[model samples]
Target: MHSGLPNGEHALIVHQAGDLSNSCANVGPIMAPDKKFNVSAIFGNIKVDGTKNATIDREIDWPKDISLIGRSLVIHKLSVMEWSLRNKDILPLACGTIGFASP
Candidate 1:
């Protein structure tokens, strides 16, 4: 992901809703269909280089039941650990809806 974000590790999560009408805040909470938080909801962290670019060359092991088709991929301002420890405020830096490419 090429972003204007600062060089640091940022949190990546998939929200329940795909809505971006009111910015990332409208994306809703991390996708917890079971009404419980788990490893599935965490997409891990994206390390931004000095050039503000992040690359994930490996395939992510996603849960089969959770469909990310219409969900939103949110890039938080802080890393997962920082956000969890400091404050629960998930300040989003960027957001995009997950979808398949057209043929």
Candidate 2:
């Protein structure tokens, strides 16, 4: 993903709902199907280079039972490390709903 965000590591997460009606606030909580709050829902951090672009080349491992389709992927203003340490609410910078790619 590319953004005008300051060059730094940011948090990426998958929320339970695909709703973006209220910005990123109404996306509901992280997609923790098994009630495991600390696991699958968090996609860790994405480092934004000087060009303000971030990429994840590797495949992310997620719970097989949980389908990411129709879910919301959110990019947070702070890195997961910073957010966890500071214990602050997630500040979403951008978001998009997950969907299938075209053939």
Candidate 3:
């Protein structure tokens, strides 16, 4: 997927959103059936500019045991504003889902 975040550091995390709960609610740093964001499913971090098109081509190393076929890939906002008075929640900028490639 191409980079949608502004010129800064951002991470792509896989959230379990194809079940009873929503993806944003079940957040985590590891892969699980009911967990939110899976760190193990992270493609990686990327730097992008909001003004220009900085397309990112990510390669997925699928887990043989975990089925993230319909999971959500969420882009998180990470910056130096953590020390500020703003809310410390890791806000999700965007979301995408894993799907089968058409022939």
Candidate 4:
């Protein structure tokens, strides 16, 4: 993790001076009713901590018969999804808000 960033959030690699962007997460089942996951017939929570100290907190609410885990998700500081495409020079992830939020 970055030397200046808070500990125990994202999976960051610590270097001699600080941290870089080679981080990840388990994206596993969590404790809460986050209705955003679309799975968990009962509401569940999926809290994503990203670079720049940005966080995506939501609830997963689905019908009792249906369950959906995050097959696909994006870690971005973007206010909108299309922001990724707007950048032709910078990689979407790089230009995403995470850069500013990350240490």
What C-alpha lDDT, on a 0 to 100 scale, does residue 100 get in candidate 2?
97
Q: After superposition, how far is residue 71 of candidate 3 from its true place, in Å?
A: 0.6
lDDT tens per residue, model 1, 47-76: 888776785423577656667899999888
- Give the 10-residue window scoring lowest on summed lDDT in candidate 1: 33-42
Q: Cα miss at 25, model 1 (Å)?
A: 1.1
Ranking by TM-score: 1, 2, 3, 4
**What's the lDDT for all of these models?**
0.77, 0.78, 0.57, 0.27
Ranking by lDDT: 2, 1, 3, 4
lDDT of 4 by residue, 1-103 (tens): 1223332222111111112233323222222335554443211112234443433244334354432332213222232333324542222121111222346
Clashes of 1: 0
TM-score for every candidate vs. truth?
Answer: 0.79, 0.78, 0.57, 0.24
RMSD to the true structure for each prediction, in A, is 2.8, 2.9, 6.0, 13.7
Clashing pairs in 2: none
Can you list the residue pairs that collide in candidate 1?
Answer: none
The numbered model that scores best in lDDT is 2
Worst 10 residues of 4 by lDDT: 11-20
Best TM-score among the predictions, by candidate number: 1
